[model samples]
Target: MTERAADGTGVRGRRKRPTMLDVAREAGVALRTVSRVVNEDPTVGSHLVSRVQAAISALDYVPDERARQLRRGVTGTIGAAVRNLTDAHPVLGAIDHNAREAGLTVLAMSTEDEEAREREVVTSMCRRRVDGIIIEPISSNHQYLSAEVESGLPVVAVDRPLSGLEADTVLSDNAAGIGTAFRHLVLHGHRRIAYIGDHERIFTGRERAAAFRACVAAHGGPLDGMVHPGAVEPDRVVAALQTALGGPEPATALIAGNAATSIEVLRHLGAEAGRLAIVGFDDFLLADILRPALTVIAQDDAAIGRTAIELLLARGADPTHPVRTVTLPVTLVPRGSGELPPA
Candidate 1:
């Protein structure tokens, strides 16, 4: 049973893929010369390139993408494992831009803030043999990646650190952001401030919550019924709000942890939102158009993204380099809401 491919390769059912060695043999050139020619290395003489091209044409030698990548010691592509892709993420866009400028492609996957999903997405990227990985770690136990890390796979954590694993991290200075938010409210005459954000189990949530508490202690303000760190659900937020506003000493200011928390707090507050001094962490689109305009402790998305890519590339370049944790600065965007005096 004899057959032929389009290039006239003899085959029965499936034709064997041609290797670079075959190209070298057909070209009567050294393997390294063929490699240089295939990679378009300018150092190769014109005659050598012509010979290689002619041989490639004759043997129908199609170089395997993975083989070329292996020979070059890089895949020229990175994997981005972020929280989710369903929403608009400026950080992801920045990462893509930076990666493109470095002559690399990006493959993005969603973790959805689930530990299992995060592991699956990241491990899948590793199996695919990506050059490096940029991860928004939702899993608390990243010891699973120790083998890959030891193997010199550059893993950079964005938005949070990988627990049980010391990897390059890019954070948004969460404590500083929270402290700034609190001061902004205090300057506006908010004596009693309340905070509701993501669960304390998460690193950002823990950092922000601790910073808020520190602010209260420093200002000699009451702490009772002022801090709420739990799930960002309507029922939980509503209950926390009721507790914060109903006690003997009601909170005059509110600080929502993340964008989702801010939206939920606003939705629950309804008309009452106008009377409360509010500050949120993490800025999103149309944050300015809200009725009272949302004041927020905005993470530097561009800086964070750029830093994450930088860390990933650096780790790839020098695996023995000490893992660094970059804490980029955050900003307090003052709008009408956070500037309001105590109600």
Candidate 2:
């Protein structure tokens, strides 16, 4: 007997639908023995198991994943939310790749840098009832995340720590990275240093700015020339740079918050790029190809992504485990631009 699929493709006409019964018959074993072999049961005798497995393979038998998932009470799907996907953000790519490798489907959504949209996306994922969630939280309120955690769904934060949420997190050491950049500038005889960054509402930006202040204070340097916050847009950052550069005693060095900020600083420092020293957090492509090249604090975005997914999956497996916060280290990559003397 045979069955045909909707497209007239032979479902069983070409070859009989191979089953465990067929494997048992071919191996001359009981149905239970075939089941044990198919399940890779450790109690099964090695010799008999090999025989049944060979028969199953020869018959092209396949296990039903949907049935397995149903029996396990899991959907085999994970939901992930990020700020943007088009940036080829290394972290997002890693999480997506790792989740797929672990046999979990990923539903990705972008918040487009909007907090309200972030909440909407998260709400949609919750309605879909994903097995777990990995979020790059757009806002400081962890209340939104608490709902998921309380519902027994595992949630992992990536890149930034959740402000009020008690959940597992994977992020780079933002404070340490900023401190290193500040120290490097100070070591180069830059007493009047300027800090330019994003809004303090974000954990990363806040930590970086705080670290810069602490480092400068420790060296008896005045913090009077700090630029306005939340200058991610190029125009805004350029304006801030102009204001900082026109200070009473212009800043001898500038510590940019991240890659986006670095772009603006570079544009403002064009032509005389090698004159004013600058150090940026987060390395970007072709950093070394710029006129004077750029020095940066490099975070392992891919590593952060991979670690967050693994942690989320582990938590999903055992929700009762203690919550952990994993902070990865950042590296300082010195280049010609950050080493320049005061203009």
Candidate 3:
């Protein structure tokens, strides 16, 4: 039996385990080259690969999964945290499919737009040691993310900005889309326009709000009565629209912040939908089926998801690379509603 330590611990002191460095030293190659071979990086030459393999066998060294994860600061798994999984957001599906094709597993979680829940979800992913993360941030706590990034983990913000953290991001051009929507309404002689959107704390929401304000001012429209933010839920958006349309001079047209909001606004209008013109940010399934097909500033959600994963994979493989932001353009689809005349 192995002798116990002086402290009366049952376990005896063993020789320190041989690490990748020891293998690299014996293999006569740089630490990075050994890491490349271990990771199956194609850049490693055959001669170095053979040497590393020979050294690993001679030393009888067993690769430590936990140590490897710690050394790379990655778990070979990617995490995606969204607002909801059942929202039928095409982007979620795209993310899952693309990640699988890239030889990376995706662990998706939903925060339901709650800050506390969001924090919990992030913490859980960290505990699992995900290789990287792509998130739709819910709040302005950018400092928390900065700490995570500082820990050598690669993070990318999708559909939003990480308030204060310097990280890679992939998002739609919200300002351009909003500007396009506003201009479309104005071109149709919509002087009284109402904008309904999500909470301002979200990066996309803020950008949409800013663009709406700027466009209204640039087009010489009334910015005061034409702006309405913080109406994300269906019931809230319905109520907001009812109030906006009930005013002394109701809006001639409405601009929805997203597809979900458009659905709510349309439901609120019901049979009166034909009476008011509408332009929305995202395209929905039944948009073309409505009495007057909905006009929308459509974004490629799937592409957004794919691009985000690509960015994360690139960065994860090369931590020393500079962070990048990839912005995809939005297109405005014209339909009967967008061409409606003022009330």
Please give, for residues 1-343, the per-residue lDDT of candidate 1 as tens digits.
Answer: 1221221222422567776778889999987788677767799999999999999999888654433332343336788999889988999999999888776678999999999999999999888777788998989899999998986678999888999999999998998999899988888888999999999999999999999899999999998999999998999999998999996789989999999899998898888899999999999898899979999989899988889888876665545568899999999998789998887
Poorly placed runs, candidate 3 (over 4 Å)? 1-75, 145-148
Clashing pairs in 1: none
Question: What TM-score against the true fold does each predicted structure earn?
Answer: 0.79, 0.76, 0.78
Ranking, TM-score, top scorer first: 1, 3, 2
Using lDDT as the measure, what is the rank order of every candidate, best first? 1, 3, 2
State which candidate, 1 or 3, has the greater TM-score.
1
RMSD (Å) per prediction: 8.8, 9.7, 7.2
Q: How accurate is candidate 3 locally (lDDT)?
A: 0.79
Tell me the tens digit of each residue's lDDT in model 2 across 21-125.
677899899867876665556899989988888888888875433223312433466778898878757777788787776766688999886788888888888
lDDT of the candidates, in the order given: 0.85, 0.77, 0.79
Candidate 3 worst ten-residue window by lDDT? 4-13
Model 2, residue pairs in steric clash: 198-230
The parts of candidate 2 lying over 4 Å away from their true place are 1-75
